[model samples]
Target: MFCFHRLGLRAAAALIVGLGIATSARAEFPDRPIQFVSPYAAGGANDFLTRLMAQHMGDELKTTIVVDNRAGANGVVGASFVAKAQPDGYTVLMGNSATHGTNPTLYPDVTYDPVKDFAPIGMVGSVPIVLAVNAKLNVRTVAELIAYGKANPSKLSYGSSGIGGTGHLAGEAFNAAAGLDMVHVPYKGDAPAAADAMGGQVSMAFVGVASAASMLQSGKIRILAVASPKRSSSLPDVPTLEEAGFKGLYFAQWYALFTRAGTPAATIEKLNGALKLALARSDVKKAMASQGADAAYTTPAALNTFYRSEVKRFGEIIHRLNIKATN
Candidate 1:
């Protein structure tokens, strides 16, 4: 009995030591530089926001984060790269509504499964899209714009950063809900899209508040409605689509972070904790506000649920409107 008791004690000690080593390994995670992938080109809103988040998140993690831009196919290139990378905590994706929510539904050949291949970390923020027309247009309100589009049919044209983007879907939703026949004009990015709208190359475009702020201030465009459920703090005077009499017409581009799906749960917890801390920083919030982005954070579980629902909602809109990706 004495020998047996000693043997049991030794085995228990070994097990405890093993567990301690495992815990230590997790605690020491991210000892090296982390690779943050943004699947879009540099200088766009997505890239800018991703870089900003990475800076603060890196500071919290006490490690360097290198942003790798792999632009192509509307975020598919970077997303696929991260999806196939080792399921370690070092490789992550800065994905948005397009990469995770709409691109999968819009592209029949999408390589990565947004939910199946990635473990959501948390949401960074959301930019409310605004519907604005060239000041040259005679319409003054959302109702008037709809009436004009209905009366003019193809005579009304709207530009978007790209097809199957939040802006594109918002335009299509408007067309269906208000019984309008506005044509969609796709541009390389929001800058060109807004520029064309101001130049009268298109009647209007659904653009993010940050990208459209200059034109809104310069009186080059007249914002008819914001695509958020409520008025944005950035545009205090602007009303939501619901407030504009189009209840249930809502759209916003949300940005979130993710890692390969098989990353250890403990690592995810650590990353999520760091993310919450970074988002809570006042400077981060101010920087986001400057870009018309609200610093909205969510737990990993909450983000997963929200991501799934957004995928479904965006997919339904794509099908309902028969929207297609032009590029």
Candidate 2:
């Protein structure tokens, strides 16, 4: 009888200890506020999303969350910083396609592995790319742009945000799919490239929907076609590239949340839960939609699959087009 009593006591103690461990893990998961890093310029689409997401995430997590813009080096410096950070679920990188999928193939020594260095939390959103041309150029439709490019050959120059940007890849996809010979011009960023395109410095450019929304509305630039899988609700009148006969040329600025690798699974899941809830808010949905951004909060496993597929997708395109950074 004493042995059984002792066994019962030991079991109860083990149960109590397990409960304490679980409670401690949950408590330490986020002992303090969190920081979300935006590796893009302030006022940019990605930066705006980061700030808004931070606010909403803070509300969800019941902790202060802030955005720190570390905009430079095509998101490499900031991404590298996050990659080397402690996997403590405190510092998260609001990374985009540039730093995650496209840079690995574009920059040989980018200082971090896109797949291995970080643990995926969730995919935030993606900004669709649109083919916009100077309003006065008299090119309003995709057919007209294709015709003009074919007839003028190297005379029609297309600008991109930068080398290896989604806009750049969109332009290359256009040329590949339509067999057009347009001169490719690389710009410093989306705003500058769209500026030149609006000013008629270039005949056309693959512009991010957010970057070109104002110009398109003001008649500064005419959108030829959208490169997204579906027509943007903000620009429902515009047709998709595939609908315009340029199939297999989809491109967009995909954004996702990630933390340094080796973060505890519970910690990662906690962050993901907060983000998921935050992104589902109506205001968050509306803000993202206004910028032509999709409110897609993908699971870590789903994000990993999508990231790998995009890497492969762009890799094939790069290899086929001989796209090398000629610095």
Candidate 3:
């Protein structure tokens, strides 16, 4: 009887040890590299910020985070891909205003539902949109550009990152407020739109400040007014569209991180924590600021609420403006 009792105690101890080992294994998430999808072309604000966050977030999570560009249909292609990906934390997406905010209403056949198909990780940052004209046009201020556009309506045209992007809506708002008929041109991303504006392919380009930052120094494009309620820190000297006599004109491009929906709540929390840590870093914040983006972070719930509100807001704006996707 004594021998049998000792064996039972030993078996119990071994069972406890085995259970502990199983728990430890389960806790080990992201043992491999994570794929970070950026739903825009490289060199744009989204791509730039994604790579920046990936580097720091990967360090925090102790895993490799690869940034993949899947550019098409104003973020539809990449967003849809993420929506259909396995609900593991390994596959993530750097979603932005165009992908989560305006695309639903703009694209009639978009495959993914922004709110239902993905879980929100956290907010990244936002950059104000600016109206920049080619330097060759000799337009310096909002008033001068408005006059030039009015005088030569046929020659005046505005380019945007894409048909449903915030830049596109900003251009439409400008057209309505100024009573001008400038043609709307769409490009794959903000970088291309800004580049074409500099090359005189378009009279002006409505783009995020980050896309226009480097080009501003080349004397190729002259920013007339920011399409935001206040001046952007990146272009502190530039006037807001409201201050430039166009009241109620405000547009900003925001970014965030998301994983496929139905991911374990614990995993989402873990990823969110890493993202918060990354954004809190001084170097990351400084880099984002230098590129005209503010490194903003929020809880998963807060980001979801904000994203839903933005979708509703953009829907109303698109409806009122009668904006239609050209692509």
Best by TM-score: 1
lDDT ranking, high to low:
3, 1, 2
Q: For candidate 2, give the lDDT.
A: 0.87
| TM-scores of the models, in the order given | 0.91, 0.89, 0.88
- Estimate the lDDT of model 3: 0.90
lDDT of every predicted structure (CA atoms) = 0.89, 0.87, 0.90
- lDDT for each residue of candidate 2 in 1-327, tens digit (9 for 90 to 100): 999999999999999999999998778667798989999878888888899889998888888987888887799988998999999989999998888878888888889998889999999998899888988778778888778777776788889988888999899878877878888999987888888999999988887887787776677888878998789877899899989876677899989999999999989898899989988899899988877798899888898899878877887777788888774
Give per-model CA RMSD.
4.0, 4.1, 2.6
On the 0 to 100 scale, the lDDT of residue 324 in model 3 is 82
**lDDT accuracy of residue 96 in candidate 3:** 88
- Give, for candidate 3, the lowest lDDT window spanning 10 residues: 24-33
Per-residue CA lDDT of model 3 for 121-214, tens digit only, reads 9999999999999999998898998888788867899899778789999999889889899999999778899999999999999998978877
* Collision count of model 3: 0
Q: Please provide, for model 1 over 20-62, each residue's C-alpha lDDT reduced to its tens digit, 9 standing for 90 to 100.
A: 9999886677889999999998887788888997898899889
Backbone Cα, N, C clashes tallied per candidate: 0, 0, 0
Model 2 is weakest, by summed lDDT over 10 consecutive residues, at: 318-327
